[model samples]
Each structure stands twice: as structure tokens, then as C-alpha cells.
Target: MKKDIEIPKVEDISVAVVKEWNDEKTEEVFNVYLINLQNKQIQNTLVTSKGYGENQSTGEKINTSVLRHFIGDLDAKDFAKIEPIIEEVFGLNNEYWVSFFQNNQMYDKKFIFLPETICDENMINVPLLNKKGVVI
Candidate 1:
């Protein structure tokens, strides 16, 4: 006899730029990660920049384009329940700094927000990054 199993409802989700490192002098990139508080899962994505040049004298340069969108969804009550956990995971306060990008341009891209239908399945290489915030 098989016993019925109950699945826990997902409470909250969040995305944050975890770290940025210099891959090459002309090519720096960022590592972004998504977190599911209810499930304690993480997904990491890499992003890069366009032009390559250094500033005179100061010797600093812009290595990457801004990441416009990072978004997620969860049950309202769940969000409240895990708000502290989400903040700790992302190391963010009420106002966090994020790179901004333009919308609808060739550079514009969108992140994926797992729909209710597939929230229970693993989403790999889902093209979950874009100019706008996460897309459901």
C-alpha cells in the first residue's frame, strides 16, 4: 500500500547578483543566483559586458553592462514567513543596488520566473536572464 505524500507550498523566491569577478582585463563578468526560500535551492547564471577600454589616469574601466532584471514569486504569507531568510541569502537590505539596463533593445533580455505549472520541476538553461526583471 502506497502512502499519500503532501508537497509543501513554495513560500517565496528571490534573485541577487552574488559576485562579480575579472575573468580578463578586457572581459569582466558577474555571477547571479536565484534562491527558492521554501525549497532551499539556488541557481547561478553568468553575464558579461560589451565595450572594452580603460579610463585615463585613474586606470579604471567599465567591464560589463548592467543587469536589468532579477525577479521571483511566492505565496504572500510565505514571503512574510521567509523574509529574513531571503534577506540573509541575498545579503540585501530594504534598498539594494543592482545594475540597470534598457528595455526592448537588442541587449534587452528577461529572466524566467517558474510558472505554477512547472515550479516543481528543475529548470536548467531556461534563459532566465534578460533586460527586464524576471518573467513568469
Candidate 2:
């Protein structure tokens, strides 16, 4: 029965890891952002993120604490800062599960950044934010 349920596809929205100047404007910091590129607005947005991976040297499994953020509403062609990400977790799998309602319909999707996928080699000009980072 689960397969019979209709699940609408989430489109035009993206999660990006951005590199930005620190508050003092001295150094750069990495942050996560939720971008909504739809033609309409989304409400009651909830985003949860976590990181997990294996240590190459010790072969140890690693997992970070899950953080949940509630973004009340997001306007069309806009973006909201989800959280600040420490560079140490760049070697892990960063996963973000986002849920929101648009036009009275609910939408959900999982956006993930694989280990080391946030490197400079994969950086791009993220829309709306206009910053350099990897988008999922």
C-alpha cells in the first residue's frame, strides 16, 4: 500500500554547502543553506541534518549528532541559512532531509553530500546565494 500512495516530487529546491567570510570578515567558514527556487512559497519547513562516515586510518565508524531546524516559511527564489558546518565533518556523508508544504501540498526529499564531495573540485556557483560550494 505504501507504493500506491502518491508522493509528489520535490523540484527547484536545493541544499548547498557554502564557503563564506567569517563574522569578523577575516577567514572563510562553511555553512549549509536551503534554497527554494520555486515560483511560489513554501510553509512550515523542517530540515534535519547529520553526518556519518568511516575513518580511513583507524577504520572506525563515525556519526554526528542529528540537528533539526524549523524554517517557518520560505519565499519564492529565496534561501535560508540552515546551520554552520565545521570543516572536520567534510570527510563524512552529510545528509539533509527536508519537508515542507507548497500550495497546501506536502513535499519531502533527502539531499545528501557524499564524503569528500564538498571539496573545491566540485564547487559551483550556487543560485540565489551566489556563493561557491557543492549543491545536492
Candidate 3:
């Protein structure tokens, strides 16, 4: 019975972590965004993000507070800013669990940025955001 459920695959959706200059703050900052690349809209979008990992030097396990964002809807080829991320958590494993509706069906996926994966070396010109960052 458990295997009878239809779980449609999630495609054309992405989560990007962007590093950009915040003119008002006079410093660079990290921000998260939810991108919809499907031919249709994404409705009732919800994203939950958190960071967790062990400190390399201190050997202490670290876990950041989990934050939930309700983005509502994202039009085709459009995107929505999810949250602002602090650079301090870059050393941890950052994860974003995303769920939404498309074509009246529910789909979800989990994206993880491994430790130190958000560095400048891995940055790319992210779509829609027009800034350099990592996307997973």
C-alpha cells in the first residue's frame, strides 16, 4: 500500500546561495533564493534551511537554528529570495529542503551544500540573481 503513492519527480527547480555586495550595509553578504525554471508556476512554496557539521579544529558538533520560509508562489522562470545567510556558517553543511506544487501535483527535493562548498572558487554567475554564488 505504501508503494502505491505517486511521487512525481521535481525538476527545473533550483536553490542558489548568492554572495553579493549589500550597498546599504556596506559589506558583502550571503543570500538564499528559490528559482523556478519550469514552464509553469510553482505554488505554495516552502523551504526549510539549516546548517550542521563538526568543527574541524575544536571537534565540537555544531548545529544552526532551522528557519522556515513561505515563499507562496513563483512564476515560470522567476525566483524569490528566501533568506539572508551569515558567512560564519559556511564551514558547516548547509541544507535546503524545498517543497511546492506544480500542475496540481506536489513535489519536493533536498539540496545540500557540503562543508566549504560556498567558497569563491566554486561560485558561478547564478541565473536570475545576476550575482556569483553556488547553486545546488
Candidate 4:
């Protein structure tokens, strides 16, 4: 006789872009953070980030930054901030791609930034699950 077994998959991982303003709030910088929402820990993680600027009329894409980092272990309900220097003028047709791995499994999320998101809001909450979760 054969017995059936179940396997578990890694989930509950997310990313965020944090912004900081200067004394007069004239200049700002950004940081990317990897959030683990699960109760357990994930090991051997790698996070990669890239930015793109798209042309609405011509349909052309431009590369902004190609960043990669290795996060050894991530605790439960914790987060890891990857790189701390993001300088980009996000227009209406700009987007970001952030990919990562957890225990040999790969997960990724993308964020499309509009002019209103940056100009109106102070902190941009980028969710790690899907497009919507990361773009808010």
C-alpha cells in the first residue's frame, strides 16, 4: 500500500519602498524592504531590484537601476531592507521589478508608480504578494 503525503510551500513574503525627506522636505531618498509575514522563518534569500521608464507613445522602456543582495535569514513577522539609495524621478509610465528567493523558492513583485503616488503621498507601501499589494 502507498500513502499520500503533503508538501508545504513558502509564502507570506513581501517588499516595500521606504522614503525619507530632508529637513525642509525638499529632497527625498528611498529604501527597499523585504517583509516576511509568516510565523516561520525563511532562509537563504536573495533580493533583486530594477527600475524601468516606459514611453507612452513610443512604447520604449528604459533601465534605471539593477540591484541585487543576499539576505541570509528572515525571521517571522520581520523584514529586511535591501539597499538604501534609490534616486529616481518616477513618472506616469514608470515601474519597478523586485524579485527574491526563500528556501530555494523564488518569488517576485512589481510596482507601477504614477505621478500622483509620489507627489501626493509621503510613504509608498509596496506589498510583496502581487502587483496591487506592492503598488499602493
RMSD of each: 18.7, 0.9, 1.2, 6.9
Model 2 over residues 25-113: C-alpha lDDT tens digits?
99999999999999999999999999999999999999999999999799999999999999899999999999999889999999999
Per-residue lDDT of 69-95 in model 3, one digit per residue for the tens? 999989999989999988889999999
Residues 1-136, candidate 1, lDDT per residue (tens digit)? 2457543322244443322234565642334444334343222222221222454567675333433233423222222111111212221112222222222211212333221212213333322233222212
Question: Which prediction has the highest lDDT against the true structure?
Answer: 2
lDDT of candidate model 2 versus the reference: 0.95
Candidate 4 clashes: the total is 3
User: Candidates ranked by lDDT, best first?
Assistant: 2, 3, 4, 1
lDDT of each: 0.29, 0.95, 0.91, 0.58
Q: State the local distance difference test value for candidate 3.
A: 0.91
Question: Of the candidates numbered 1 and 4, which has the greater TM-score value?
Answer: 4
Runs of candidate 4 with Cα error greater than 4 angstroms are 1-10, 21-28, 55-60, 85-89, 92-119, 122-136
Leading candidate by TM-score: 2
